[model samples]
Target: MTVQLPPLPEIHHPKIQALFQKSDRELVTLFQRHPEEGQYFAAIFCRYGQVLYTLISTATRSPVQSDYLFVKTWEYIYHEMRVLDLRVTTPRLSLQSWLINIAAMMINRAEVPPVEEIQYSLKDTPPVFWCYLNQALNQMAGNLRLVLLLSQTFQWSHTRIAAYLHAEGESISASDVKQLLVRAYQALEDALPEDIRDIYLAQPAVTA
Candidate 1:
């Protein structure tokens, strides 16, 4: 598939190093304010680009399709971030998870050839389950919700989650990740309606 994508800023751009010092939220804020400044977004891409591409590529198993979705995902992020309120997205996810969510949305929207088997999208999900699950996740505290999304949606290790959180300015450890996940699971069960749980159990597992 031939696709059009905006060229990334030069790797040796002088601002890249300086922007790297800023955290994800900081870079997001900067990009929000100055949509014309590509460097801030570039730095964000540098931080998670490989993981994001890997996610899309892993799910697609087609480099051409992966490249198309990769570009589309960033294109979505480029616009979405402009109006994105960090406070109250449905899933209340961390930036990494949020980015992956965008990629998943894009992936699900694409027409997969009959030969391909995809994972980690809401494609086959029941609508009621989707709504209820979002509600359940949203009911949790920010840290717990973020931890659960990272752990369950992306299957990131506690150490990886802790390290990423620490880099984002939180003071946390792997022990904290495990403890929060325990609470998150309980919180999810309490937040979900019982009938929805029964319905979800009978369906194919939904992945983010």
Candidate 2:
């Protein structure tokens, strides 16, 4: 949680620390308005680095791929910051949503490994994919959603998931974990919007 970006502790110097104190909108303005001052952009990066990393890592499920996309996402942000007009964006996303959409876009665009090795690799998708995915997930049952997220995002084994639930006093057996996962997949498919389903159908099937 601490800002440890090298050579520029965003919270170290009084002036730099002040950048951290500003709101996202404020930080964004400084980032755009004063492209020469990296402190503003650095502050935003330091603030959201963990969040972005978590999002990328969960989606990719491969440490190596996650690392690559994490850096690339920021690189994209750095290059596109000037032209990003949050106010005028369709559907009008806040800064955080915009950042997430960028990550989702990048993840979708990333090349898939050979089909044999592609377990959780996602296909190229429209930005609306991320937007609607949140809504679909919200519609799923609590237990189903939790199991699905843990399996897909964390790549947790069924036994690991059972142990996790057991420790939490839920006593979910591994067999139950398997069943829950099946239902979870069905639930997710049923919950997704029609457009998203169409998008998935349009893509070549990924054998996972």
Write model 2 residue lDDT over 79-119, tens digit each, in one string: 68767888899999998899888888988896635434533
Cα lDDT over the full model 1: 0.68
TM-score of 2: 0.48
Clashing pairs in 1: none
Backbone clash count, each prediction separately: 0, 0
- Cα displacement (angstroms), candidate 2, residue 2, comes to 15
lDDT of 2: 0.68
- Model 1 lDDT per residue over 37-129, tens place: 455666777677667777777777665556656655776676687788767987687888888888888888866544344342322442223
Off by over 4 Å in 2: 1-14, 112-208
Per-candidate TM-scores read 0.48, 0.48
Model 2: pairs clashing at backbone N, Cα or C within 3 Å: none
